[model samples]
Target: MDIHYRADIKGGLLILHPAMGIVISGKVTIGKNLTLVGGNVIGFSTGINNPFIIGNNCSLGANAVIIGPIILEDEIKIGASACVIKNCINKGVTLVGVPAKEINKA
Candidate 1:
């Protein structure tokens, strides 16, 4: 797992299991209690300077990819192999599929 020096883990009880293959950019800001599975990629987009901001209690499934300057609100659940390119402002929901759309309100 490559978590850049500038990346901040603001919350407690964060878990990065099998941390291998997880790439987090320095410009990212992660909230508390995050559980990231293997093969997760959280970073910026091409030519974009803004950083990715992840809210608290988020769970990213295996092989999930979240790129670009986006905001993931609290309690967001990303499904396996999901790709999130936009901001997931809706809290307490499960997002799935390519370009990840909210599947369940939860």
Candidate 2:
């Protein structure tokens, strides 16, 4: 999907099929092979005042939420029902939990 300067998308990079429902807000950058479901939201957590940035090759699971200026590196994988509300991550890693922690390496 493509989100411009002030638009909102459910997720950054969702699948081409109907299953990947991508919703985003503000300035976000997405990658490849991302899959999402309905009701998924990726937007600015700071009440539409903050601009966000997401990295490449990342996958946000069903109902996954990404907020803040999150810079996810290449090949970053987020599990279903996960929420990210902070900093950034490296390349080739799996993130889970409420704050989206790195569980495994790629």
Candidate with top lDDT is 1
Model 1 residue 95 distance off true place after TM-score fit, in angstroms: 0.7
- Model 1 residue 70 lDDT? 92
Report the number of backbone clashes for model 1. 1
Q: After aligning candidate 1 to the native by TM-score, how far in Å is the CA of 99 from where it should be?
A: 1.3
Overall lDDT per candidate, in order of appearance: 0.85, 0.66
- Consecutive 10-residue window with the lowest summed lDDT within model 1: 11-20
RMSD of each: 1.6, 4.2
- After the best TM-score superposition of candidate 2, give how far the Cα of residue 65 lies from its true spot, in angstroms: 0.6
TM-score of each: 0.89, 0.70
- Candidate 2 stretches with Cα past 4 Å from truth are 1-13, 16-21, 47-51
Quote the lDDT for 97 in model 2: 89
